[model samples]
Target: MSTPNHKAYWKTNLRYLAILLSIWFIVSYLFGIVFVEELNTIRVGGFKLGFWFAQQGSIYVFVILIFVYIRLMNKLDKKHNLDK
Candidate 1:
């Protein structure tokens, strides 16, 4: 493999991070606060969707996003020949 390009690797990594963070912010903040009332109308089990998202959903999504980021970064690293 050729030498890994730090600038390009970090740039793509940051881009992925920004996108994931944006989604997390939207779900945890927007849906939890701004659209909570609307979302409250929908129920998941015994909990209001909004409340669930604010309390638990965001956490779950964050964990999932962490795994997704790991997988994505792994692929990216390999693509850039940085896995070594």
Candidate 2:
């Protein structure tokens, strides 16, 4: 790939990382800690929402985000003609 396309590819990758990491941080830290009390007012499967996020939800989200990142990188690779 040309230099410009190479730079754009990495830039997009970094942006994706930033956005996904931010989501993980919010779900794992904010919902699990900072907003625990408010979230605890609600429940899921008999477990407090905040506690669930702290213990399980965040892990689920992280796994989902891994798939999302893989899909995204696949598309990005195709866009940058790097899929070969």
Candidate 3:
């Protein structure tokens, strides 16, 4: 790829990373820690929402985000004609 396209691809990749990491931060830190007490007022699967987020929800979200990132990268690669 040319220099400009390469730069664009990397910029888009970094943007994706930034967005995904931001989501993770919100889920793992905000919901799991900062807003725990408020979230604890709700329940899910016989557990407090806050406890779930801290213990399991964040992990689940992380795994899901992995798949999401993979899918996004696949599309990006295709767009850039970098896919095999």
Candidate 4:
């Protein structure tokens, strides 16, 4: 319905990427590793929260994040006519 703009699409993609990257770093690196003990009390699935995060949760989140990032980038590429 509307003409696509590459510059706008690229800018939006960069913004979203920065935000998601920040969250991923904080959650998996900071909360999961740096503050693990302080977070242990918040448990789920029989695993101490922080411990789980550091051991397995971070891995899972990273995996999901990888897929999400791929999808997001694909959409961005399509929006900007950069997809091949």
Candidate 1 local lDDT, 6-78, one digit each (tens): 7788889999999999999998999988899999999989899999989998999999999999999999989
Compared with the true structure, all predictions reach lDDT values of 0.92, 0.95, 0.96, 0.83
Q: Give TM-scores for every candidate, taking all chains together and pairing residue i with residue i.
A: 0.90, 0.95, 0.95, 0.75
Number of the top lDDT candidate? 3
- Rank all candidate structures by their lDDT, best first, as comma-separated numbers: 3, 2, 1, 4
Model 1 spans with C-alpha error above 4 angstroms:
1-4
Sequence-dependent TM-score of model 4: 0.75
Each candidate structure's count of clashing pairs: 0, 0, 0, 0
Residue clash pairs of candidate 1: none
Least accurate stretch of 10 residues (summed lDDT) in model 3?
1-10
| lDDT at residue 29 of model 3 (Cα atoms) | 100
The candidate with the higher TM-score, 3 or 4, is 3
lDDT of 4 by residue, 1-84 (tens): 445475688678889789778878987999888999989988898788999888887788778878888999898888777888
